[model samples]
Each structure stands twice: as structure tokens, then as C-alpha cells.
Target: MPKLLITGIAGGLGRLVAKMARSRWEVIGVDRDPWPSAPDGVVVHQFDMRKRRFEDVFRTERPEAVVHLAFVRHFRSDPATRHEINVEGTKHLLEHCAEYGVRQLVVVSSSYVYGALANNARYMNEEHPLNASRTFPEIRDLCEVEGLVGTFLWRYPEIATSILRPVNTLGHSVHNAIGNYMKIQMVPTVMGFNPMMQFMHAEDLAEAVNVALEKKVRGVYNVAGPGAVPLKRALEEIGRPYFSIPDTVAHTLINTLFSLGIYRFPPGAIDFIKYPCTISDKRFRQATGFRARHTLAEIFASVAP
Candidate 1:
């Protein structure tokens, strides 16, 4: 069986991919946190990605393919610290991938890399410039990571590097900004802005990663669910009532809540609800012959209590 190394194996998506990929590949997982138990054909390693010891995993495992999902997504860490983990850590991983002869690299990125701007097209494609930092400064690290990976992708054509920029992924196991926002009993919305949003179930994203590895899909692709929905409709479907507040007032309240430790998301996250960042999955579907097995409703239901 082919060997596969997955970073961020403790995360929801990483764990799912490891479980799903185990039957087909020799799976080795690395994360900053330890897992209680390793899945049936998988081994888990606990260590920070930035440390030199990370290379030890690559040296020993010598994986033919790597799924990079170890990015920091929570607001628990400050921007500088997050940058070290997200940007610097990914740089380290890429350098090791080149040195270790990893043939295929699948990097999990976010649609947030494309800023949620009012002027955004109905469906942003992979070629769209990453302007997420213009509004959400916290995600600047992610954008930088993508840029660095893109440069590496071109610089080394020998490695089949596939970057997946998935939209908001939701599942009971996934704890993310959108998932937390949707679970709120009283959801907050910006006045006069109900953006069109797309969601991909965690399983579908895992399947996409598997496809990228199995097929050696090269180039950047956007992975999204079957369809789009208005942000308000999504909340309504979840049985959450939303109250609209002016942008300034909403930001101030969210900032205060963040300062008080009542909210985990930063104030800049409000832009996701206020503007659309939906992506086109046509390229991904055509290249890999992959379609989302879960419908949009099923995605929401999976996360719903």
C-alpha cells in the first residue's frame, strides 16, 4: 500500500481523512495534540509542526503523499503566534516535502483566502486574487501560506501539488467560525446584508483530499457543496432567529464579546456573513470526477442539534 502522511491529524477533517484513507493507504498522522487511540491502520505522532522533529516523521514515514491540514483556525492564539504555526510551519513542511521525495502534496486551504468583498463575483474561481487580508487581517497568514505553496507548486513540477480551497465546512465534529456562528441560539446578522454562502460537509472534503492523492491531481481547485443558500435561510433552517445590527455596532459588540471571552471569533469575521465568497467547483469536478455526496440540507442537518 502507498504511504500517506497527514498533518493536523487531530482535527476533525484530518481524523476523517485518516479514517477514510486507512483502508487504501498506510496512514501516519502528526499533530500538536495527542489522539486517545490511533485508527485501525494508522499511527499518530504528537508534536508541533514548527519543530525540527517534524522532519523526523517525514524521514521515517517517507510518505509518497502528504495531506497538509495542520493550519491554526481558532482565535485562541494571537496573530503572530498563529502566523508562526500556519505560515512558517507550512514553509517548513513544504521544504521537507521537497527534500523527502513526497510525490503528491495536498494542501487544505480556505475560501476565506478570497476576501469576502461586496464586489466579489457570484462564483470566485481559483485564479481570483487572494485579498482576504484587506478586510480580515487575522487570516493574512493563511493567504501567505497559500501564496508560498503556490510558488512551490510552480517551482517544483516534479511534485504533484494539489491545493484545495474549500468553503465553510460544517459537521458535528468540525468546530469552525461558521459552525459556531450557526449554532448560536440567537444568530447575529449585519443590517441589509445577507450573503450567499456555500458549505461543504467534512466527509466530502475528506473525499476530495483522497481523490487528490489517488489521482495525483495537480494545480489549485475549489471544492464546494452542491449548492448555495442565503445566510439568513441557513439560520432559519437551523431554527435560529437572527437580529440585524448596524455594521459598526455589530463589530463593536463582537469585539467586546471577544475581549470578554464570550465569543471565539474575531470582529473581522463579521464580513463573512455580510458578503459572499462562494466558489466554483467546476474545475475540481471535471478534473477528479468527484461530486459532493451530501446535499446542502444534509450538510446543515449534520451540524444541527
Candidate 2:
């Protein structure tokens, strides 16, 4: 079995992926927090990706492939720190990969890079230009991160870079924005506005990452489910009530509540409301011959349970 190194193993999706990968590969995981348990046959290492010394850990492990997932995940709270970890830390990892001759890397990215919203007709293929104007700070940071990773590939064509851009990953992890909303019963289904929603189960993402490792494809690809379900329909399927407040009202209400410190939304949550961002998985399907096995309904059901 080839050795594999996965960052952010302490995260919900990382833990799930480590559990699945350990059965076949010699899985090694790294994260800032100490992993609570080693999940049977895997090795977990603790390290902050933001530090200069993080490269030393990568050098010592020298795994055959890497799956990078560690990130600050929020830009509004602190733009500087978000860039430090998401972009600088990614550069650290890629620098080490290039130095050590690591052949394959699958870095998790987001569809927010595509921008606020386009007409539903746009399939969001891999060729779409990354969103500009710094529309949302979170995506603005991702645009930087993605460009940095792409540059690494450009510099070293021999090394393959696989970018997985998944939209609205719904899974059992409480850390995910949408999943957390569902957990706290805070997600309000808008009746009048039903934006196209695309999601993948956590298990499927892990499996897809594993497949990326095996296929060794080079270039950017969108990894999402087949169909785009409406947000209202998605909430209804999850057994949640739908309330479609008018566009003006919804914005005012959320902004007012947030101003009072009564609640907090994800960094790009509000911008996404109007954009209805959705991505296509056709490129990934053609590259790796992989398809999402679970439906949004099934994944939401698991998360709710």
C-alpha cells in the first residue's frame, strides 16, 4: 500500500476520510489539535500549518501523496490570519511537496471562487474564470490560494495538482456551516426564493479524494453531485419548515440580528443567498470515473440522525 498523508485529520471530514483510507493505505494525519483517538490503524501528528516549522513535519513524514484540507475557513473574523493559513500555509505544503518530489496532491477548494451568482444556465465547468472584485472575502482568499496552487503546478509540470471544488458539502460534521445550521435548527428555508443547491455527503468526498490520489489527474476539476436541488426543497426534504421572507426583508432581518450580536452567519453566507452558486461535477466524472453514490436526502438524513 502507498503511504498517504492527510492534513486536518482532526476535522470531521478528515477523521471520516482517515477511517476509510486506513483500511487500504498507510494513512498518516496532521492537524493543529491532538487527534482524540487514532482510529485503529492510522498515525496522527499534531502541527500548526501556519508555522514555518510545518515543512519539517512534511519532510520527516515524506508520504507518497498529500491531501491538504486545513484552513482558517473564515475571512470576516480576520482576513490576515485566513490568508496566512489558507494561502501561506498552502505554499509551505506545496514547497515541501516540490522539494521532496511528492507526485500527487489533492487540495480542497470551494465553488465560492466562481462568484456570487450567475444565471442558472451556466454549468460552472472547470474553465469558468475565478470570481474577481473580491466579491466575498472568503472566496477572495480562495482565489489567492487556488492561484498559488496552480502556480506550483505551472512551475513543476511533472507534479500533478488536483483541485476539488465542492459546493455546500452537507455531512455529519458540525463544523460545516450548513450542517451546523441544520444541527441548531437555525436554517430557515426560503419559500419564495429557491436557489439551486448542490451537495455531497462527507463519506463521498473522502472517497472521491481517495480516487483522486489513485488517478493522479492534473488540473482543476469541479466535484459535486449530479442534480441541483432547490434550497426550499432541500430544507423540506430534511424535515425543516420553509419560510420565504421577501429578499429585502430577509437581508434586513439577518443584518439587524447580526448587528445585535444575536447570531453569526458564515463569512460568505449572505452573499451566497442572492447568488445561488452551484458547480458542475462533469469534469471530475470524466477524469476519475467517480460519481456521488448518496443523494442529498440520504446525506441530510444521516447528518440529522
Candidate 3:
């Protein structure tokens, strides 16, 4: 069986990817922290990419492909380190992958690269240019990661790369992030009037990664849920109430809470709440032949208990 290396196996998405690929591939999971449990065929390595060199691990494993999910999702602790891991870490990973002659590389990226704007309403295709100016620090940093992948793909055509831009993904055992408040019956803060939002199940995203690895599809693809709906409707679908909050008030409260160490938000996470983020997955679906079996209702149903 071909070998596959998955970074950050301690994460929800990383675990899902390992489980999805275990039956077919020899899976090796690398993470800084110890993972609770690994899939049957997975070998978890307690490795920190920040302090340790990953090239040694790559050469030892000699993976046929890689699923890069390691990232700094939060920037509160160390802004410089966040950029180092997300941006520089990616550069390091890509250079090593190219050197080792890895066949395909699957990079998981967020949709925030598009920026927070209503004009991004249309299903954003892979060809769409990322918004260069983003106010949020974390969003700007993530945008750098996306840009790095684009550059990597252009520079190294020999190594096939599939960049998946998934909207809000929720699943059991994973941190729900924005969708969690709705699950608790609290008024989910809406930035403005009804704004359409789309999301995917983490398991589905894992399956899509598997397909990408197997097919070696090169290029960027937007992978979202069935369709887009108003944020209020999404809250209702998940059995939660929605409350409109003024942007000024919300931002003030959010900043205040963070300053007091009461609550913290990723740089761009709040901006996302204020705007609609909808992407077109037509090309992604057609290419991977992937379908989301679980609906928002099913996901919420499992969480309700």
C-alpha cells in the first residue's frame, strides 16, 4: 500500500483524514501534542514542526503524498510565531515535498482568503483573486498561506497539488467554532441583516481529501455544502435563535472581552460573522464526485443531546 503523511493528526480534521484513508493507505500522523487515539492503521508521531525539522520525518516515512493541515488557527499568543508556522511553515513543507519527490500534496485552507465583503456573494471560483487588503490580522496571515500554496503550485508543476477551500465545517468531537452557540440555543450574533452562509461536515472534507490524493487533481477548488442560506436560517436549522448586533457594538464588546481576557476571537472570525461567505463547489464536486451525506439537521441532531 502507498504511504501517506498527515500533519496535525491531533486535530479533528487530521483525525478524520487519517480515518478516511486508513483502509487503503499506510498512514503516519505527526503532531506536536500527543493524540488521544489514532486509527487502526495510523502511527502517531509526537513531533513539533515549530522546534524540530520535518525533513527528517519526511525522508524516514517517504510518503507517496501528504495532507497538510497543520496551522496556527489563533494569533493571540504570538503574532510573529503564528505567521512563521502558517506562512514559513508552509514554505518549508513545500520545499521538502518537492525535494523528496512527493507525488501529490493536499493543502487545506479556509475561505477567509476571499475577504469579508458582500460582493463575494457569487460562488467564488478557484480563479478568483484573493482580497489583498484584510483588516483582521489572522485573516491576513491565512491569506499568506493561500498565496504561498498558489506560488508553490506554479513553481512546481511536477508535484500535483489540490487546495481545498472549505467553508465552516462542523462535526462531532470537533470544536464547532461559530456554529456552537447556535447548538446551545443562544442568540448567535449576526453582524447585519440576513447574510447567506454555507458549511460542510468535517468527515466530508476528509473524504474529499482522500479523493484528491487518489486522483492527484492539481489546482484550487472551492468545497462547500449543498447550497447557501441566510445566517438566520442556518441558526434556525441548527435549532438556535439569531440576533442582529450592530457592527460597532459587537466589535467593541469583542475587543473589550479580549482585552480583559474574558473571551478571545481569531482576527478574522468576527469579520466573517458580519458578512456573507458563499463559494461555488460545482467544479470540486464534479472532479471528486463527492457528496455531503450529512445535512445541517443531522449534524445539529447529534449535538442536541
lDDT of every predicted structure (CA atoms): 0.90, 0.75, 0.77
Q: List the residue pairs that clash in candidate 3.
A: none
- The weakest ten consecutive residues by lDDT in model 1 span 34-43
Q: Compute the lDDT for candidate 3.
A: 0.77
Model 2: worst 10 consecutive residues (lDDT sum): 131-140
Question: Candidate 2's C-alpha lDDT?
Answer: 0.75
lDDT of 1 by residue, 121-237 (tens): 989999999889999888888999988999999999999998999988999888887888788888879999999999889999999999888889999999988889999998887
lDDT by residue for model 3 (1-305), tens: 99989988888889888998988899988888778767566888887786555888887889988999998675455667878888888888888899888988999997767866756756777777777245566557777888888898999898899789888787776664554545555674755467677777778778889988877899998888656667677777666665677777777887887777666565346657666667788898889787877786775554543
**What are the clash counts of all predictions, listed in order?**
0, 1, 0
How does residue 40 of candidate 3 score in lDDT? 69
lDDT for model 1:
0.90
Candidate 1 to truth, TM: 0.96
**Candidate 2: residue 200 Cα off by (Å):** 1.1
lDDT of 2 by residue, 50-166 (tens): 776577766777788888988766434555777777888888888889887688888988776887654533567878777633555545777888888988878888888888888
The regions of model 2 sitting more than 4 angstroms off are 75-77, 118-120, 132-134, 189-191, 256-262, 266-268
Model 2: how far is 152 from its true place, Å?
Answer: 1.1
